[model samples]
Target: MTSQAADRPEQVASRRSKLTREREQEFFDAVLDQIRECGYDAVTMDGVAASTRCSKSTLYRQWKTKPQFVAAALRSNRCPRFAGIDTGSLAEDLREAARAAGGTSDKDQGLLQALGHAVMQDRELQQALREALVDPEINALRDILRRGVERGEVPADHPALEYIPAQMYGVLRARPVIEGEYADSDYLVRFVEAAVLPVLGLT
Candidate 1:
């Protein structure tokens, strides 16, 4: 056979490698879905392998442990929906931001709820989840609020401007469990008026 004909096998192998990578991603997503459905404590690498039709060793090779695998999965799924918070007014910007952040995402919120105990027990998991899911969004929201100060919509010295994102997110994350109500648009607006807007002197 010609050398060009021999290269056909190489091309086929490369295409197979691409499919392998895609299947690996599918396995990871399936594991995350099982965790969300059954809770983290209920999931096992062996179980994931059985469900995904892969070897348990494959999962271990890809991610050292369940925590490591879950952390990577959480990182992979993080989305930056709050990157466009410009509504031309601080109150409106904040309202929009709250809308973007109000509801828990299906994967994220479920993973967070399930992994809370696991994370508390594992320092690596705690750090990984915080860096992956929490820190980037928090920092970006801070920057959005800082721009509001620059635009003079909020006073440079406004305490609320500095703390609003944290308060809003903290409440949004906690209030459902603590108060049994979702952080809907109306509730978020009320929070802004009673807690945030007054501090910024807008109310």
Candidate 2:
């Protein structure tokens, strides 16, 4: 066989990999948008393939099941939104974090709400949700608290330190359930100022 013939298989695989990568985001976006529009149960592999203009077999080739597909999509969209927030003060850092979270709260909360009990049944989906949405912000918030302790703004052993993440996350998830409204930017900022700041003994 000629060298060209020998290399054709490798070239074909490389091109296939590139094509998969290029279409990956399109698939992810379609599934997420569908989840947002219709709850998780309503989002199917066939629906996603139709939305993305790909074959159902193509989706199955990429991910074997709807849960696997959604989990992969969530993992692919991982963005550490609260990373790199430092303002020389824990109060300001938290305020900035609230602003950052509030910016995407509606969409994120909607996804979580849409996923709802479906995530409870699937460990992979649960992990993907936490990795994509929950863990990064919690880690970043803890880092902010650690910096506060180092700066002597808050004592290292302060009782409230451990609960900060819960408090922040709780409010975001709770406000809508309580009042039928999202915890938007202004509401989050005020929460940071009135509730969170006071707990930390900050102005």
Candidate 3:
């Protein structure tokens, strides 16, 4: 067999010998906290190694580059905020979604802001951020809207339907920048009731 094929078993064995899930989550948590504190460009593998008390080589073996490491950490940290909301009313579903989004930790928002510049420059980081932070939420929001359409609460051809995710997420991400406060659950629910539901004739 070729050298690469011959090495596959040993590689898999070595990977299987890596840190347990709990230990790896510790590493990921350290990485995210470091990124929040230091910004993406400033966080180093050595810093993560020192903070998490793991050998730098261990990190390098698991993720060869800093971008890859950060991406993996971002993916690991994802918590789907918009899952399993079946309130049977679009307005209520959205309000519940807003409440969930607002309840998310400040560290999440901070990490996205911290990595914003770096993500623009690295395709992998951007993909990771979208996969971890963006896609699941967007998909869930779409599901909510789809359910609304099925229930005849909103028309599928409504122009505003396409922009619901953007509108909600944009405000969620922008509120801290513009207003100097995280958009908490109350604010989000109010916003949805006032701005979003009315537009769809739910109000």
Please list the C-alpha lDDT of all candidates, in the order they appear.
0.74, 0.91, 0.90
What lDDT tens digits, residue by residue, belong to model 1 across residues 1-203?
88667787658556542336678678768877987788888989999889888788777866889988887776766676577778777777777776676554434666777776888998877887887778877886887788878998777877566677688768777766887766676777678778877777764
Once fitted onto the true fold, the runs of candidate 1 whose alpha carbons sit more than 4 angstroms away are 1-21, 105-107
lDDT by residue (tens digit), candidate 3, 1-203: 87667787668666567689999899899989988898988899999999988889999988999999988988997778999999999989999999999898366688888897899999999999999999999999999999999999999999999999999998889998999888888999999989999998887
- Ordered from best to worst lDDT, the candidate numbers read 2, 3, 1
* Model 3 misplaced regions, further than 4 Å: 1-16
lDDT of 2 at 21: 73
**Top candidate, metric lDDT:** 2
Tens digits of per-residue lDDT for model 2, 1-203:
87667787658656554345768999998999999899999998889988889899888867899999999989988898789899999999999999998999999999999999999999999999999989988999999999999999999998999999989999999998999999988899999999889988999
Query: Could you tell me which residue pairs clash in candidate 1?
Result: none
Off by over 4 Å in 2: 1-18
Clashes of each: 0, 0, 0
